[model samples]
Each structure stands twice: as C-alpha cells, then as structure tokens.
Target chain A: MDNVSQEDYLTAIYRNLDEAGEIKPNLLASKLEISNAAVTDMLRKLSRDGFVDYQKYKGIKLTGEGELYAKNMLRRHRIWEVFLHQTLGMPWDKVHDEAEKLEHSSSDEIINLLEEFLEYPEVDPHGYPIPDKNGKIKKSKTVVAITELNENDTAKVIRVNDDVKNLLSYVTKIGISLGKEIIVKDKLEYDGSVLMMIDRKEVNISNKIASNIFVEKIK
Target chain B: MDNVSQEDYLTAIYRNLDEAGEIKPNLLASKLEISNAAVTDMLRKLSRDGFVDYQKYKGIKLTGEGELYAKNMLRRHRIWEVFLHQTLGMPWDKVHDEAEKLEHSSSDEIINLLEEFLEYPEVDPHGYPIPDKNGKIKKSKTVVAITELNENDTAKVIRVNDDVKNLLSYVTKIGISLGKEIIVKDKLEYDGSVLMMIDRKEVNISNKIASNIFVEKIK
Candidate 1:
C-alpha cells in the first residue's frame, strides 16, 4: 500500500486475527474508528490485492502476505519504542506515540541497524514481544491479569496490557513497573479494588487498572 | 501544508530564496525534480495558503509563515541527519536518504528531545548550520571553495557543498571531512587539479571536487 492508513489497517487486521482468530467488518471499523462503509471498501480492495480473504458474512482472515507486512510493521514499531525509551531515556509512557510516527518511515536497513544498535531487544518498554526480521515473535511466558491473582499472592509485573500514557504515568508514580515485585495485600469485595504492597508501600489499584496489568506468579 | 510534497516545496523555496534573492518556477521544478506545471500548481496552492507570494511570470517568494515552516522542516532534517550519523554511527553517505524519510515524521516534541539528546548541536553531519527552535541559524565564519586557496596555504575543511552519496563516499574514503586539516601543496595547470597534504599524506583532487569543498583559512 502507498499510504500509512493502509498499513494501519493491515496491522490492525493482523492484531485482531492474532488475538481473536478472526476479524469482522464492524469490529475493524470500531477498532480503526472508521465507518462500516469505509471498512467494507477497504476490505474489498485488500481482498482484490490478495492481502485478505473476505466473505460477505464470514469473518476476515489475513493472507500470508498481509501477515508478513503486519509483522514487519510491528517489528519497526516496537524497535523504535525501545530506541526512544531505552537509548534516548524517554519516558516509557511517551514512546508509543513517537514510535507510531517513526515506524512508517523506517527502512529495512534502518531497522536492521537499530535492532543491532539496541542489542536485539526481545520486548519493548511495555513488555510486548518484538517480532524478528523474519516476523517471528518468540512466545512469551503465560501471564495473567493482576485482578486474577489471589489475595496475599506475590508476583512480578511482567507486562502492562494498556499503554495509555495516563495509566503508565500513574503506575510509574506509584512505583510499579515491569519486573517490580508486588504482593496482593487484599482484594476489597465491596468495590473490586485491590490493595497491594509495592516496595513495602501500600497502594490501592482500581479493578479496571488491575485488569490492565499482567503479572507472573513469583513462586 | 498537510503533506510531505508541500513541505518539500516550501523548504526548496526557502533554500532558493536564502541562496539567491529570488526563485523562478523552472528553477524550483528542477530542484524538486518535478515538472514546471506541477511546480506552478503547488506555487498557486502555496500562494492561496499565504505561504508564498507567487506572481504570474516574475517569480515566487516565501512569506514569513512559509519561511518559518521551511526552517522547521530544515531543522528536523538536519537534526535527524546528525542523529543517524553521530548517534547511530551510520555512514554520512547513507544518512541523507534516511533523514529525508524521518524528517517528515518527526513531531515537535521528538525534534526537541532529539535536539536536547544531541546536546543542541549547531551543525548537521555535513557541517550545515541547524536552525534553532525559533528558526534562528548561527552563521559560520567566512569560507571559500578549496580551489580558491593559494599554494602552501593551510585551511580547515568546513563543509561539503555536494551531498551526493558517491561523492560523499569518495571524500570519506579519502579522509576528507569537516574539520580536517589540509595544506595546499601545488596547483596543476594541466587539468586544474590541486595537490594537497592531508594528515601528512599528499593527495590530488580535481578542480570539480575541490570546488565542492568549502574551507576556512587557518590564519
């Protein structure tokens, strides 16, 4: 595709397919914030271009070519995020937006050099696995939402599902980050808020926020 | 301007206006490698947008807003070049094309961060002055083409006027770069070639190549 919007659609479709095994036009529209008509038009074009297999009522599936394109885009995006956050010392919360802009412009040579320069990082600042040059993403260990953890269970913050700046900033302010050790002190039944101990400091996180944080059991 | 082509046109206009006092449609067309009709169309659009003062036959000039926009794009382009060459260790010959792609995508915040990260560099990798945030550029000392220096005169390489990859790569291979010390040894009248001493080694550069290099006299 000649434009970034087309790339965005391919990436969105790949992500939806990866997560849900299929993509619906209405779902794609909602995800892209575009109208159903626009989605249908794009789907037709993509199908004609052999990037997708689309049927009138059946869900959409990415063709092999589309999957490769999406994976490459993802690799560029995550690598840029790592460069901004790790090498440049930018705050993790602020890197996503910058990476989004940079990914579309990065050439293969640039990405290759960047991958080497960053010492071949496996994951981005948000703990999302980065795809290799060949679009191979190493599967990560199983992780569960913090809200799924039992009271008094200790876990390590493996990833944050939500990369929203405000949420990241809030978590950072409360001294919570990837690899941080947290103990679930209590789960309030009244409001679904979870009381946790981070670095011996007690903090209460709303269930919504808790659900967005993925953690791995320590023991 | 909403797109890169428009921004490119504005920057080209600004550069032409800065180098020469005026710009003609044909000159701009050649500079941008586009047709005269395309240049005329864009100039009209820019004129409508109040970014340029375009007359039917006389010439075109950038308005204050247009100059500012051009300066910003130039600033982003040079800063990215510096980042690619200095921070990423990319060869100078390879940075220009990469910077061209990156400049359009860099946001104000990213540029600002990059400027700070680079410790507020005054010039790009090619020794061209980088515009400040307010579009202010610090002018360098007076310089002249290398061919202008008399025999036995010492000078410091200040800038390379030509940025063509092959030319840059050749110069780089010959150990010619910004701030390099050289002494004029002889001028061959046969082909207008100049003999010079660089790092205690004698080298001969053609007049064409010599003219592309600007140097400041070493007093």
Candidate 2:
C-alpha cells in the first residue's frame, strides 16, 4: 500500500477480474513480471489487509473495498491520460506511461478539479471509458472488433485498445483513429491480414492489430 | 529513499544549510516535528549512505550528491506549485500542500516538459527562484524584508515566504502579491505594525507578517 507496485497488483487483479472473471496467482506473477513466491507473499498481505479474498489453492477475488480502490485508481489514471492527450498535446501513445506515474500521487481534490478542467470527458484518447467518482463506468454496447467485420463492410472507429504503444503509433501513422470511417475491402485468407480503406487510402493491417481496434458499424 | 519522508529530510537539511551554513540535529528534529532520537537515527543512516557528513558532536552537512538530489526535489516542488497556482487557478494558499504530494512522483522527463509548458518560469508563485536542472540557483540581490523599510519608503513586492497558509491568504485578501508596489505610510512603534499603501488603498500588517514579505526598494 505504501508503494506503486502494490497499487499495480490491485489494478492488475481488477483488470483480470473484469476481463476473465477470476485471477490465478501464476497469471498475476507473469503479468507483474515477479516470481510466484513473491506474488504469494503479496497476495497473503493483501488478503490480511482485506483488499483481496485469496486462498492458497483457490483463486483470488477483490473485496468490495479493494474493488473501490482499484476503480478510483483507474479513474485517476484515465483522467490524467485525457489531460495529457487533450490539453498538453501529448501523443496518445505517450500518455499512458505518464498518466501511470501521475495517478499515484493525485489526491481526490486534484482529480475532481482535473475532471472539471477537462469538462468531464467520458473516455480517454484511446477510447476507454473513464470511471466516475463513484466508481461507476458506463458500459459500451454494439461495438465489435474490426477483425470481426466482413469484407466490404464499413465501420466508424470507436476505440483502440492501448496496451501496446507501437500499435498505437502504427495506427496513428496510418490515420486510423477515433471517429475515422474505414471500409474492409478484403481479408487475406493466407495470413489473416486485412485490406482496408481509410480516408480514401488503401492500407493493410495484420489480424492481430485489427483485433485491437473496436468499431461501430456504419448504417 | 523510497518514501517522501526521506526526501523531506534531505530537503530540510539543504534548506537549513543554505540559510544558516550549518545544521543541528535538535533543530532539524523540531523542524520535522520528530523526536531527537529519530533524527539521530536518520542522520546516522544518511551519514553511512554518504549523503551527509555527520560527526558525533558536530552538526551535519550534505554531500555534493545529496545536495544535488535535494535541489532536484526543490525544483520539482516549486514547479508543481507554479502549475497549481498559475495553470489550475488554485488559490496560492492551497498550492504548497498539493505540490508536496506531487513532487515525489514527478519524473525528470515530466518536470522538464512541465518547465517548458510553463515557459521556463524562473520563480514560483511565491517568488522563490526555482533551481535549474543542474541544481544551480540564481541568487537575488538588493531584496530585503518589508519590516526593514522605513516609513514613506516605497518598494515592489518580490516574494513572500509560503510556509504558512493563513498568512498567504491574508496577504492575498489585502491585495499584496508579487510585483505589487507598496509605500509604507506609518509604523506602530508599540506593537511593530506597519501601515502600507497597496493599489491606492491603505492596509496594516503585523511585524511577523512583514518580516516574511521580501521586497526591493523602488528607486
């Protein structure tokens, strides 16, 4: 609780729970790049502090208090990312790391003021919805990955998963960003690559990269 | 080294050494609101770590490396204060505490970028010169406390010591801020109060408050 690594662990657990509905110690150790023994020690401590429900053999789950804390951290992180991207003109690829550092030190007052300063942005530059002060996030429906779309279908880019900086830079270089209209011209069966028309220019994207982009179909 | 308390100790030592050319353990203990024993223990550790030249009977002095580290911390703290007051429109009285929290988490890259964003301000909102990245500070000459000026003397406000929030709020309410021109009208000999004219209006300030405001005589 005194260091950023502890916060990272809690957030990682929250993310895993959100994505997969459960957390395994081995998976957490890999995610954090720490050894399994170290992860066990931390999990034991977190369990003792009532931040996690952890059993030696069973998996892990966040308690109510733990979920609230993780959600607040996420809120701070996304708000800062938005500030860096929109206000400071930082590249979307560059905002995540800076926001990660700033989030640990931001107080509730600063976060609220920043939220007001940014005029209550609903999502970050990468299109991830920011959690509200009360830890409630508005779920987005009717959005599917670009890789799921059929050939000749057109869609409007909604969000891009920002887990990789290189992918974001690549996407930005190719003019694939939020609100851009893209048409799937063809899907190569040989390598799973896709040919798309963005801004009236044809571009090729690998299936891996295409899956990271979420879009809403254009009527 | 991992927590803000450690940074606070180093900066406090640097400030004392800069102001008085020496530091006593008891004085440092009082300044930090810790016990003498705790101060001694921390000093011993700092000495062993080569950050301070601590002797059994004599006082302590920062090593060259320690001085640099402390200066960097000061630079970050002052920069954040300037950002909070100037950019965020936070009340000057409320900036110091927020800056204290932010300085620890700010990385070197962020500080440099922020300095650019702020147009490389030489001084913080309180008028204290911010140290450069190399830990070099420009010393201001011809500045003296308002209490030292005689009646009928006019001076331009330079900087106010920002250690006390109530004093900062009171000065702001009285329209005394950086670059304001003030003329001393009268000095109350019995209680050491001074009546001054600011913005074409007269205001009285206590001797203690006057001592904290530095100003340069208007030739």
Candidate 3:
C-alpha cells in the first residue's frame, strides 16, 4: 500500500519478527497500542496489496516485496543510529529514539549517501546488522550464552536485545562494547553470579544480566 | 495553528523575507502551489495562532513566535544539507531535496547531534550560511560581482544564490568552488567575456556566466 499507515504496519511486523522470530496479532496490537481488529484490518489490506501472505488466523509473513521495504527501513534506522553515535558522539542508548523518527523520513538519496559517508557499515552502534541497499543482510555468526561459558573461554559482546535505557548506559559505563572481549573466570550457581575478566579487569555479573548478554565466542 | 501546513507557510514567509525584505501572498501561493484563497485561510489560522500578523489585501508577516519556528526549520534544513554533503558525499546540487524532506523530520536532538558531527559547520554544501542552533545567523561580510571585475583584479568565489542543478554541476565540473581565487587577465567587454587565471592556468568565461558568479574582493 502507498499509505504511511500501511508502511508503518509493515515495518512494525518486520521489527517484531526480527526481534522475536514469529509474530502474533495480539503481540502486534500490543506493540502498536491498537486494537486487534485494527491489526486484522491492516493485515488484510497488506495481504490484498500483495505485501504479505496471510493464513487467516495464522498471523502474517512478509512477501518478498514487503520484506525488502521493511529491510530498507531497518537499514535507514540503523545507519542513523550509527551516525548519531559515531559522528555526533551521542550515547548509544539515546540514538534509537532519534533513529526511529529519522528512518521513515529518509529518501533513497540520503540513504545511499549515508552508506557511502559511513563507509558501508555492516552493523549499527548496537551491533545489529545493517542491510545493504539491495536488502541483503550479512548474517552474524556469533551467538553465545554467557551462562554456558567455561573458565578461560573468551567471547566478544555482540548485542543485547533488551530496550532498557538504564541497562544500556550501565553497560557502556562498565567499558563493555560490541567488540570487547570478556573471559569467564568463575560461576556461582546458588546466586547465579558470574565473575569475569573484562578488558583485564575483574567484574561480577548476575545470571539475569548474563542471559541478556549475547556474544561471539572466540575461536 | 498546530498544523504542519501552518508551519510550512510560516517557514516560506521567513525564507522569502530572509532572501527579500518582504513577501507577498501571491508569491506564497505560487511557491506552495495552492490557491490565494487557501493561503488566505491559512494565514488567518496562523494569525489566530499568534505566529503571524495579517492585514487584509496585504501580505502577512511573522510574529516573534512564527519567526522563531521558521528560523529553527531553516537552521535544520541547512545543517542536514551539510551532513548529506560533507559526511555522506552527496553532490552539492542534490542535497536540497533530501534536506527539505529531512528538515521537517528531524528532532532537536538529531539536529544538534548533526551540528556537532559536522563540527558546527558555518555554511551548507551550496555555500549558504547555516544558522546556529539558537537561530543566530552569521552575517556575510563580503560581496563582489564577477561582472564588475577589471583586468588584474584578484577575487575569491564565495556564494552563488541560484540553486539550479545544471548550472551548479557545470560550474563544479570546471573546478570552481567556494573560496577559489582567480585573477582577471583581460576583459573583452565587446562580448562580456573575460580571461581569468586560476591555479596558474588561464580560463575564458562567458559574460552570461560571469554575471551570475558572486565573489569576494581580495585585499
């Protein structure tokens, strides 16, 4: 659909699936803060517009065209986030809100120029893959649970899926970033607290926090 | 009015007054591609909103609040233009349309971040001054007409008011840019043509072309 609302719905669907694999109408409705009927109405419209494949109550999947459009928006969002952080020195936690507003308004010219200006960045400040102009995403091969790490095993932090602003700021304050490595030294099962050496400094992280951290294990 | 249309009208008025001292409703109508009556309707709404002062049968002027908002938009527009050019490597002539779309979409945070990213740039890609974030514009001190130059006069190219893409690209292709200095060797007044020395090489410029070039006088 040519309407902005339709585009927003498509983008929301893409984002939800990107973060959570599959999407439910109730989940989409809650995320958009709209009624389930509204989501159903738009889903039908999207399906009719050939942007989505819908199986009645089976939820929604993006058609090829829809997926490309969604990925474009995602690329724009992540690029802006990187610009905000790298160029403007914005804190990573605060760039997402700005990116959210900028992504929808960018034209293709700006997007292309940004790609060139930033030197065709593969990931955003938060370590999320930035799709290429043709909607081709570079798959990130790193996935490790902090809880599974043995002593002396090392991995670099990749991304944290949580949206808590305080948590992001806290992580940054602790000197950990997307490419920084941490070696697990000890794990206490009773308290679920893990001790690790990060940047050659000892630190303690709780189990709840450990699960939120995703890393790429060192070869 | 709390409408985007009112914002556009106010911005247009401010831009016109900035370039020229006063703005007429017909000019606004022509620029916006809307009817005079529609502009009148919106002008009344803007007056009611305290953003403009209107008089019947005469053009409207911005009130303080209106001018403030307009200047903010102008600042954002120019700053985004710089980002698209310096950081993104966009051609100078191609930045305006993208900046126009982005200016309205940017938040204060994003604009400020961009300003810092570009190290608080003073001028846009097209050599126009970018108003500071607080809407304080840097006044240009030098103005020279290229057509008025005599033989042996050295001058620096400064600002070009016109934004026609073909002309800009053509001028840029000739290795002429803002602040490039040239010494006039001969002025053939018969054809309004001039032979100028640039970078130790002589170049002939047509009268029509020479008249459009604005420069700064050398000491």
Candidate 4:
C-alpha cells in the first residue's frame, strides 16, 4: 500500500479534488497519465486498502486515512521543494520535479528536520502552502487564476500549478514568479488569451496557462 | 540498467570486488541477504546489459560501464550522506539508510549541486570517501582496520564500513567515532577481539567490529 504508485495515486487524488472533495476516475486517469482500466484497477486496490472510496462509474473520494496519507505526502513534497530551492539554491522551475522524486524517498523525520532547517517555511517556492506535521495546512490569502481577473486588474502572483509540465519554465520566461506584480491589460475573448503586463512588459498568455497562475488581487 | 535493484547490485559488486576485481556470487548473495537464485537471476540480467562479465560458478567482475555507474551511484550516495549529516544535522548512524534511498532518486545535476553546496566534501560523516563527478576518489592517508593494529599502537579512527548493519550505532555505543583516538591495549588470539583504550578508558571490541572500524595509525 505504501509503494510509489499507491503514494502517487493518493497525492494525485488529493490535489485534483474539487470543492465537493470528489474526482472522477477519468480525471484521475488523465492526471496520472495512465489508462482508464489502469486507473480503475488502482482505485479498486486503493478502496480495498481503505485509502479511497470508489464505486463503479462514480467519483472517487479519499477516506480519512487516505486524506491524511495524501497530505503527509504533500508535506514531504513541499518541504523537499523548499530545501531544493531555498537551501540548495536550485531553480524554482527545477525544484518541483526534483522534489517530486525526493518526496517519495524521504522519511517523516527527514521532512521534520528539513522544516526546522528551513525555519518552517510557510510556502514552497511556487507559493503553495506547506502542510504541517499533523496534516494541517495553514490558511493563507485567497487567490484566483489570472484569467479570472478583469481588464486593468492589478494583482500579485502568489501561486502557480507546479504540477503542470513546463508551466513554471514558460512563466519564468515571461518574468513571472511568486511576488511579481501583474496588471491585466486586456482579456481576449476570441482565443481566451489574456494580455498581462509583467515586469512592465506586455505578454499574452493562453487561457490554460493563465488559469494555472493564481494571484491575489492588489487593488 | 537504471532500476534500483540493478543499481544496488552494481554498487555491491563494485564495493565487494576482491583484489582481482571480482566477487563470487555466493558472497554477493550473502552480502545482499538475498537468495543465491535471485542473485544469479539478476547477475544474468546484468551480464546481458553489459554491466557485468558473469559466468556460471565464476567470480563476478564489473565491466567498465558498470564501474562508472557504480562509482556514480557512490557519488550520489556519499554526497547525500554528507548533506544529511553535515547540512541537515541528521545523526551519523541515521545518515546511511537515509542516503541509500536518496542515492537512487537524485539526478546527476542534483548531486553536483549538493557537492558544491557542501563545498565539495572529501568524505561522508561515517568517513567513507566521496567519489567526484569523474568517479575519482581523492586519495587520502592509508588506513587499516583496528583489528590490524598491534598492542601499544595508537590510531585515529578515519573510516568505518558503513554497509555493515547497525555497525555505526554499535560502535557509537562503545564511544567510537571519526577522529576518536584509540590505543590498542591487547588482542585475544583465541577470539581475535582487541582491547583498546579510548578517552583514557579501556573497552574490548570484537574482531568483527574491530575489522569494520578502520583507522590510520598514529604511532
């Protein structure tokens, strides 16, 4: 049950849960980049292990034990992220992938020690909150995707979907990062791309990319 | 060729090779605590992959590629060990197991960065030499096992066989550690255990334990 694939499934389920705390098997399969049959097979195993609640043709939900496991995995991931970026001076774009592999290998003791070593970082480099030891995630400012803002909406980047492939590198190329201020210059309804002013330069981003970059409204 | 078990086999073969740079499969099985059948199965695969030159009932020898791969793994392992013990403040006894998992997960880039971050450590906390990027192990003072020291020979603990299970913890319990000075008091020819004085106190260590604890003779 504690194998790498199972651990990965738990974290993937936890990350993609909607407001209702449920996710479809199809979505889970897509997120994991596995086949539908494969997802179904794993879901059944997860259910049998008491880590997930699954019914045929229905959404998947993590059990209490499952949620705790997922959050702890997240705790390991984000802490490793902090250690790689803040302590090791690795690039933010590079830290997520490095931390992903490391998170599975590290123990709770290592995570706790890293937390103390990093002065108990509140967030990872991408600005995602770090869950505490007891699976408690500190509540931070509410954030919205850049695409949700209106024209001329001034905001500050607070978080990005670190899970998205190449998203961080693409955003970094556009001079975007945690704490960077952006002004929404225009919203193109035709292609759903947003023209935003970052670092005083105009950059147009796709709706998908804009949606992954979360920001807090400034004014 | 890059799987964890394969990597472990390569490193084990590299570490246990005799003066002629070969290891009997029986010894390898014993070292890994796996079945001889299992070791044979893996050895066949290793030979097929050109990582080893294997024959039925003959000592195993790592090919050039296998040695490079094993040394690279050692580089990852020892660098991680230094980071865990020196930078993260993990206990020396705890670092080996932690580094074992980490060695398989880290990338070459991560290992290089960690080396630079630690200012290029010459050795791990347990005193095993770290292999550099080119698989070069920096030559240092020659060391001999404490078992090899004669009566009245003073020595400074330099390296310990970190692969031996619970050896570090057991030695630590006897007040042994890197840089600790030891004076050989006597050796029992019967059991081959040695009585050594450390910190002005005498402690008798078994031959097996003494053999695992390497030191440079100071007298």
> Which candidate comes out best when scored by lDDT?
4
Could you give candidate 4's per-residue lDDT for residues A1-219 as a string of tens digits? 549999999999999999999999889899999999999999889999999999999899999999999999999999999988987789999998888889889899888988998999999999999999999989999999998999999999999999999999999998998999999999999999999898889999999999999999996
* Candidate 1 per-residue lDDT over residues B79-181, each given as its tens digit: 9999888888898888888888899987888899889989999988888899999999998889998889999999999988534447888898889989999
lDDT (10s digit) by residue, model 1, range A91-206: 98888878888989989889998899899999999999999989999999999999999999999999985344488888889998899999999999998999999999999999
**DockQ of each candidate's interface versus the true one?**
0.60, 0.47, 0.57, 0.81
User: Per-residue alpha-carbon lDDT of model 2 for A1-219, expressed as tens digits?
Assistant: 545777888988887773545799988898788999999999998999999999888788999988988998999999989988887778888888788778888788889888988999999999989999999999975799988999999999999987665888889999998999999999999888889999999999999999999999987
**Model 1 spans with C-alpha error above 4 angstroms:** A18-20, A150-153, A162-176, A180-211, B18-20, B150-154, B162-166, B173-175, B181-209
Please tell me the interface RMSD, in Å, for model 2.
1.5
C-alpha TM-score for every candidate: 0.86, 0.80, 0.75, 0.98
The CA lDDT of each predicted structure is 0.88, 0.88, 0.80, 0.93
Report how far off residue B14 is in candidate 4 (Å): 1.0
Best by TM-score: 4
Best by DockQ: 4
Which residue pairs in candidate 1 collide? none
Question: Candidate 3: misplaced stretches above 4 Å?
Answer: A1-4, A18-22, A144-156, A162-167, A170-212, A216-219, B1-6, B18-21, B142-157, B162-219
The RMSD (Cα, Å) of candidate 2 is 4.0
Q: What is model 2's DockQ versus the real complex?
A: 0.47
Candidate 1 C-alpha error for residue B212, in Å: 2.9
Candidate 4 per-residue lDDT over residues B79-198, each given as its tens digit: 999988987899899998999999988999899888999998899898888888899889988999998999999999999888999998999998999999999999999999999999
Model 4: CA > 4 A from native? none
